[model samples]
Target: MKRKIAPFILIALSLIIAVGLSACSESGRNVEEIRIGVTGPLTGATANSGVASKQGMELAVDEWNEKGGIEVEGNKLPIKMYFEDNQGKPDQGVSTAEKLFNNEEVDFLIGDAFASSVTMAIMDLAGQYEKPILSGEPVSSAISDKITENPDKYKYFWKGNVGSDAYGDSVYQTVKMLEESGDFQPTDKTVSFVVEDTDYGRSNADEVARLLENDGWKVVAYETVEVGHTEFYPQLTKLGSLKPDLLVSVFTADSSGVALVKQINETKLKTLHTAVYYPTRPEFIENAKDSSEGLVWIPLMFEPLLRESQVDFATAIKEKWNVVATPNHALGYDTMNNALTSIAEAQSLDSEKIVEQLAKLDRDGILGRFVFDDSNHTIKAGPEYIPVPAVQIQDGKNAIIWPENISTSKYQK
Candidate 1:
């Protein structure tokens, strides 16, 4: 009986030891793969911008993988991207977010680059799952406001580009500069807005109208169009009838922007056509053809007038993709690079830890020096950080025309 009891005790001890060793191994295991999920309008009206952003993110990921990937806890972890097309719809965006978080089990997430409505729809999921989102190009100020209102609830959301208010202010500044330079003068001192009927477009148009009204410019006509609306002749005709000094368009769809610009040009409207965020794409020029000429656009960053460091990145993207990099592309590259840096700083793959490091990250890249505002979780927009670059289409080329220091050409009518 004593011998039997002794054998049983020894077996029990061995089992305990094995369990301890297994736990230790699991705790110290190195991350093998870092999964990143991306959502965008890859197959809808805004597919051009979404595709460009994906290319930029892919370029950054490829570069890191070529360099043996990101190092974590003395082990190199390769990046794996899982891309989902939101198709520029709010419901689809939420579903895509759920798939990335639940099915794919991605460690990080990026994008929803084309539509602000889609970005806003996914914020609830980001908060619920505690996954950090480095948004690519969604510019609605509502996102920042939500984060600011509830820091803990929406701390995971960070804007990768300027907010709508900043964009509006930038457009205002350009108009003021033009006014001062005697390039633009209206007998009526009036302006009109033709905006997409979405959170992004409406918010930006409201901000621009507010600023213009404050500056003593009368807003003559304000019209809203659906997201994928192609026929803009009615809106353009109404705006033309107003005979305002300037026509500000806030369209996310490249097709809409081209059609509107072409119609405005063909109708010979005297109002100066300026857009917020749409005309920065190379496809805009290709689609609009000569109609895009003389159109001014407020871009988050202008690729042609990028800083030296940014120029290198632009060159790399152009060579690899055989297409010019737009502001969306720059935002994508910067967002991914920033995420990689934050992961390294956190020294762990845990989502919460990555969020902690991201809150404190302040670095410079293609989009210039970036530091998220503590309250809003958005990159501060000013001269010192990510200032808006106003680009104008001149002779079938997009050229910087504002912030004189970076201007490649004067404002062309």
Candidate 2:
């Protein structure tokens, strides 16, 4: 009996020692790898937005990691990111969100920048999982609007950038500026709106049309094209017959805008060339060339006069990734920075606690002064994402061509 008892005691002691060693080993693993989940389109038409956002997140992650990562509960852990491709589709976004929540178990989520509809679709799941999600680049006011409209439905979702109202506001200012300049008369009062039929396009176009109509401007034509509509002759011809004063083209891809530019030029539409989205960048030079000269549009960011911090960061990212960062990158890096700041201040890894810290976030970045407003979002601000420079396509490239207050007017001289 004594022998059996002794053997049992030794076995129990060994088991206890083994358990303790396992606990220590688990703790020894890098605590800094606070897994952040990233979702966006890496391929497809809107790949630019997703890829740009991913690069931005990587850039921020690299910077933070080099700086010793975040401190949480007396432990320092490096931030490790997990990514999934949503292919710029709403259904895909939902699945991506689910995978992040269930499988990856990311500490936080960011991305799906271009898919406004997709962002809205996954808002509920984010709430269910109690995981804080920083919106990557979706610009529809609807993201925070829907969340705040029904907080019970979505309490974990927040945005790090402004929305499409920037487009409408800039348009209003540009039109107003043009009117004041006396270069264009108020008689050119008819405005036409065109967009891809996606959620982002439709929502943005609706807001633009609404704002213009409220400003007492006549909407000469309001048209929606299917996502991949290649032929714009029908829409352009129909709009031409109406004789709008300015054509507001709101397509997604460079090819789409290029197609419209070529078609309109060939047809000799007499309307002023005004648009949002692509055809306002250097790429506009490749597609529309001289025809794009004097084309007016609202863009997310102007690369030339970027802040020193932004320029340095952009240069580093380009050197590392061999790709230029866009506004999407700014949003991603800001989101990561905000997350790290929250984790450091809170000193905990809990997601709900992070939400409280995020709401109080007030930090400036490459994008601009970021203060998530009552809408629980931040970005360039006034009428158009306030303070965002309204750029015009000039000499085959985007040149500051108006409201010198927001724009640097580098091309003014």
Provide TM-scores for the models. 0.88, 0.86
Segments in model 2 whose C-alpha atoms lie over 4 Å from true places: 1-32, 186-188, 280-282, 305-309, 375-380, 383-386, 408-413
Q: What are the per-residue Cα lDDT tens digits for candidate 2 across 294-389?
A: 677776453634345568777777798887656666666777787677777777778778877877777776666666665544454653333555
RMSD list, candidates in order? 6.1, 6.0
lDDT (0 to 1) per candidate: 0.82, 0.72
- Candidate 2 TM-score, C-alpha based: 0.86
Model 1, 290-310: lDDT tens digits are 888888888747564545667
**Candidate 1 — which pairs collide?**
none
